[model samples]
Target: MTAAKLPAIGCEHPMAGIARRTHARVPPYAFYEGRKQDWRFSMADEVTLVGQEAEGLAARACRGAGATEPTTRSLVAATMSAALFGPPTLGFPHLVDYLDSFRDGRISTNPQPKLNRPFAAFFVSDADRGIAQLGFDQAFDQFVETVRHFGVAIFTQTNSYTAGELGYFVRRLAAEGIVGLAATNANAMVVAKPGGPAVYSTNPLAFGFPMGDGSPPMIIDQASSATAFVNIVAAASEGRSIPAGWAVDADGNDTEDPNLALKGALLAFGGRKGANVALMVEMMSAGLSGGPWSLDTPDFRSGDVSPGVGMTVIAMMPGVDQAARIARARTQADRLAGLGVFIPGVTGTSKKEQLTIPAGVHRRIAEFAANAPAAGNMSLA
Candidate 1:
């Protein structure tokens, strides 16, 4: 989630205005290649099955982050978490970096999830390629083929929800012309000690939208982080840093050096406000949904030492009229434009009801589900 404002530097221009103003400063091309590009997936008879498979993959990734060829479950679990954050049309670099971490292991394994469910995946990120796309190709056979063959490239969730819950929500929402989206966030969850340590990497915000199209309303899911930590790690290993404002040092200073920032903390978008939103996400992702919290826990940012965070899911039903919602949104947006370019969040009331946008998925090991590990559900000796 690239912020359009620069409050850190005392510059708070409108996002679109700023982008337009700066367009001439940069290249004259669309940054994304996947815009308007359809992410066609096999028409699986079991969208629910695919969703469950995605859920399994998310959980397994945290536990089985070390496998050379992780089980379908593991890969899906890891990838889903990451995918929920970026635009649905995420760039290849972002997706690859996120997936690579599963092989390395970054998720935690404590204070397990109390809930878990299948969610329809959808989003769009603002990446170099402009946006990332995800979809379930048509046909159940195609789904099986992809899972068994190319393997799911990425799996993303914005918040915590059981596979069944997510599946039900999306299916119904789509029927009602709304989009449904879900994602999660996690971190070591450390309480900052003033001039000492920084902690907590709350997950992203989960969004569920009722479709607005004859098909389904698109989802505009996201988080506040510029990129996943995996990308930062890759850059560091290759002797590089991030774009800017992605991180800050412990002493309240921003740094392009990923290593230094890693030693410090990931700053929230609007400082304390951003941190507050992060906290909301943390509570929703982990706290409200049942994951980890730094309020009274060890820091996970110190490297999987804490019990990890959970997720936050926002399901929006845009009613049964897709065209009306779009028209209303565009109208309201235009009205707001009468004042000036409306703020980013202002334009998307119904727009936010969408789930599939553009951009990016996959990730590392995490402790448990937003609910609980299914072990307790099984009969014990």
Candidate 2:
């Protein structure tokens, strides 16, 4: 496969502005404060990059790691959004996983994603063992249009690398004034119950809906597990023990040692309730998409083959008087906030124009860029 020329590097996509405006109220630094030790970086060990520069660097890094231009563009946009508005771990840190997969042959550099419409309201995609974002990117316009026409649409994708940030999918729909619920599975690493074998991945689910009052869309994104897998990995890297009930040893005995937990399985967040949520996500994502179950998927971190996970996104148009309904919801949210209730996706405006990256993470990204082959010299085989 021949490499495509890189697109212009900038956060100029339609979602970029909406994400920035909606997430402006979030205090950017708060996400980084408490976990400095686990992340192995202090606030002082940080470098700031303008959004455009960060996106450019991310694109270069992806291209250097053998991704095609289109793949790089899709992944860079998602990465920047995650870094800017979503969880910090899912942003630049997660890009490292994609770069490694590209170099290790776990992900196709130039996958030819194929879309199928078996029904008027349902769309299916084969990612050809590439990143999940590209498949969604390709189907987005059509999916949104379908939702508008039919009042509801469902998109399912199979045979892709693990989704980097599940919230990214729904947030895009929320930007278009649609409600979106998205779910994706990874390799099996979570157990349904104490003393049970692993039967689920972290199995994240995300929901987003437009508020329509200049307030950011309300987004709720979380893993069904007690915590994210990345958090465990970070703890292990920092030689720290995790909280109790987070995981169990390979023998199904509860363990707080991150290393042991890595060898074992993560526990669900609310015991049976969280496990049920994981099961629900698995059914919609892996079951509905014809993708491999978590038990059957390969390890995303170690294998040369793709994990071949699945993602399902359901979009729904609001009811009659959509604008009025959305405004009412916003008013309710404000009233709840006044009662000291924690509202998801509502934060104070952030004034900073640039994003801060931990120096260590920035160095790793820089290395990928510095080592990338020249555009015409790339090999996609």
On lDDT, the leading prediction is 2
TM-score of every candidate relative to the true structure: 0.41, 0.84
- What is the lDDT of every predicted structure here? 0.34, 0.77
Tens digit per residue, CA lDDT, model 2, 190-262: 8899899988877888898788856778788887888655456567766899999888888988899988876
Give candidate 1 misplaced runs (Cα > 4 Å). Answer: 1-176, 179-183, 189-196, 206-211, 214-218, 226-246, 250-259, 294-309, 320-327, 330-381
lDDT, candidate 1, at 169: 25
- TM-score, predicted candidate 1 vs. hidden true structure: 0.41
Residues forming the 10-long window of minimal summed lDDT in candidate 2: 22-31
Error of 2 at 334 (Å): 1.4
Looking at model 1, how many pairs of residues clash? Answer: 112
